[model samples]
Target: PRFKSKKATRQGFKTDRAKIIKGKLRLDKPHGIKNWYDIRMSGDKLLTGELKVVSICRENGKYWASLPFEIEVANKAKTNRVTAVDVNVGHINYTEGKINTLPDNLKRSYKRIKHYQRMLARKSVINGKRATKSNNYVKTRAKLQRDYRKVANIQHDIMQKFTTQLVEEYDKIVIEDLQVKQMQMTHVAPKGLQRSMFGYFRQILSYKCDWNGKKLILADKYYPSTQRCSKCGHIKTGADKVGLNGNLKHGTKHNEYICYECGSVMDRDENAVYNLLALIN
Candidate 1:
């Protein structure tokens, strides 16, 4: 169930001490040596079993051992519960063909972190001529990094909770496969925003659905989730009152959107969520 260090395994070099306890290889005692676990064997004689060490990996400044264990895949009747999720600038909207927006606390945290980043950038530039390794510079940089990490953690936590809720509630989830990479190249939105939260959401949803015996449907990337009126199926053209330009005229801030077709004006993010819900049904 857990990976032990290759170095740890090799230092002891106790093949006889190895015992299969609880279906796992465990050593009777710690080997008083290092780098012994780094050894690997490759051959056709490798044993095959439900519990096996698959591979070892070094990633993100850490080493990991991978174990693949086979368990009986549960048999559950497929479900008909379907929902569509929309990821927008400010909030996540989801629906079973009905409007519902998930409250996102990360937006507030992001705004605060953005403010801190700007302040840090300004301070760094102002103090750049003085010194590189100055205490003030190092302290400021550390603070900035801490703030950034906090923001990232908040975003991850929120997304996990949101995605978990959706996977648990719905059997089939539909979402637009957004062209976030292209959008980043265009510089149409903040770099942080364009970094593709959809990928993370999709990843979490995919595994959760698979484990729960559900289905996930990806809509076309270019699907007009925003332009088409969900209520009447009206293909909205131009910015008169339905598109981005219309939303700007309606006093929506950047990253905010409103739909004139349904007179349902909300935070631009909520608007995108509503549009996504429409696509599901």
Candidate 2:
């Protein structure tokens, strides 16, 4: 209530309001809450059933509340459908291994972040022996922070929607448990996009599947999904590819899997999805 008494920057408090009638939230009688919280919420999902906990949080000078609720619902995911997802830099490949590139909106976010970062670096140069943070410096720093936050928010928002669709559409979802950290350290796909997005998608899909009563299976990290043939179960070797420098170039056109058994030459991601799905089948 009294958030500005001290030098407090931000503040938020939660109340266990049992009697939530319509838009008004009422606390227990013992708390002496004469007036109820007139809270209004708008979203695609209609709030129903019982409210578990109401957590109020203040972020970036904004106050928000998270209301976790329980609902009585039927099966959300279609039991007959199953899909394997292949996370990549350019796009997300699902089902038959088709690629969908990143949206222009998300690409713009990255550009803006880089612009703000350059501005922030210029601002940093003003700091010398007698130099302190000027008004312009603080303003520029805040701008950079906002840009970073925008990029993070946009990535999460897109992945959240994508993961939700996957979970709700399919009864079973399978994805590779990628060694992202190791891949990053090893300088794999340095210029490709979505290197940072795989973990985000996986984390969202995992809990969302549990909440919606769907199944999420993680293929082995060492599983040769791309190298194995989906049709005839042929394992392509490095020496098989023509003009390959060393091992087969992963995440590129050269990564194409031409099955020696069935002679099925398909896109690497598409072949991988089929191999991943075969794990559970």
Candidate 3:
């Protein structure tokens, strides 16, 4: 790992020696005037567990403390409920015919972040090189970082809610093992897929499932979930496939999957979700 730089806008140190005493965080070594700092945390539940590590960081002119703890979690009772989900470029399709998407506020946040980023660049760049920071440049950079934090928090909130809901509602959850890197390299829905955060979604779902005593099944990466007909188990080929095949635009233009073998018609993403559901049904 690279050495930590003092010039970095975001800086922090982690230590296991930190102790929590009467709702205050106290470090073993006193760096500031006092060893203990009164931290404003979101909930008191974090204080209940065995504190393991404390991380203090400063970013965007704000100081934050993160206290990670260990606790026992009782596994949820089994309900025998099962579900499958397909992560699409635009939305997530599930076996229950429910589509979940990020709210419009996230899009607005992205736009604001982009605007700040452009402004920051103009303020910092000079003669094709990044010049020394001026008062205005630093102010713009801080605004950009604030927007970055906003976007991150927004995504984190949505991810937590969506993943928690899935773990709560289903005993067994099935999802395709998507080859995200290969998809990106092949230029398949690049922008949309990146924004979708599919890999991170899977990561969150996996841990949440483990904590909730839910079973998470990963369908094979090359299982052709998107190209197979969920109704008749017929796999499409050539122009019928939902993705690129030998430079030919495959699948129906309307994003519908039609199985010639059984004449079963369905939305492409919904069909994939069902096909994944069939894996462990």
Best by TM-score: 3
| TM-score, every prediction | 0.58, 0.72, 0.87
**CA lDDT of each prediction against the hidden true structure:** 0.58, 0.69, 0.76
Poorest lDDT segment (10 consecutive residues) of candidate 1 = 9-18
Per-residue lDDT over 92-202 for candidate 2, one digit per residue giving the tens place of the 0 to 100 score: 788844544456765776687688677766666766532225766556556665666676776777778778778777888999999877666655565453434777778
lDDT of 3 by residue, 1-281 (tens): 12288777678888898777776677665545544455445655547788987787888767777878898988887788899998876578887765445568778877887887787666556523444346666677777788778767877787788888888888999998988887777655676677778899999999989898899999988898888888888887765566622114532554677777998877777788878888986
Off by over 4 Å in 2: 1-65, 70-73, 96-101, 128-132, 190-196, 239-255, 259-263
Q: What's the CA error at residue 51 for candidate 3, in Å? A: 0.5
Q: List the residue pairs that clash in candidate 3.
A: none
Best by lDDT: 3
lDDT of 2 at 263: 69
Q: Identify the superior model by TM-score, candidate 2 or candidate 3.
A: 3
Q: In model 1, which runs have C-alpha deviations exceeding 4 angstroms? A: 1-79, 96-130, 248-281
lDDT of 2 at 218: 94
Candidate 1 structure quality by residue, lDDT tens digits, 42-126: 4545434565444544432234444565666573455567777777544566763332222345456557667766766776688
Q: For candidate 3, report its TM-score.
A: 0.87
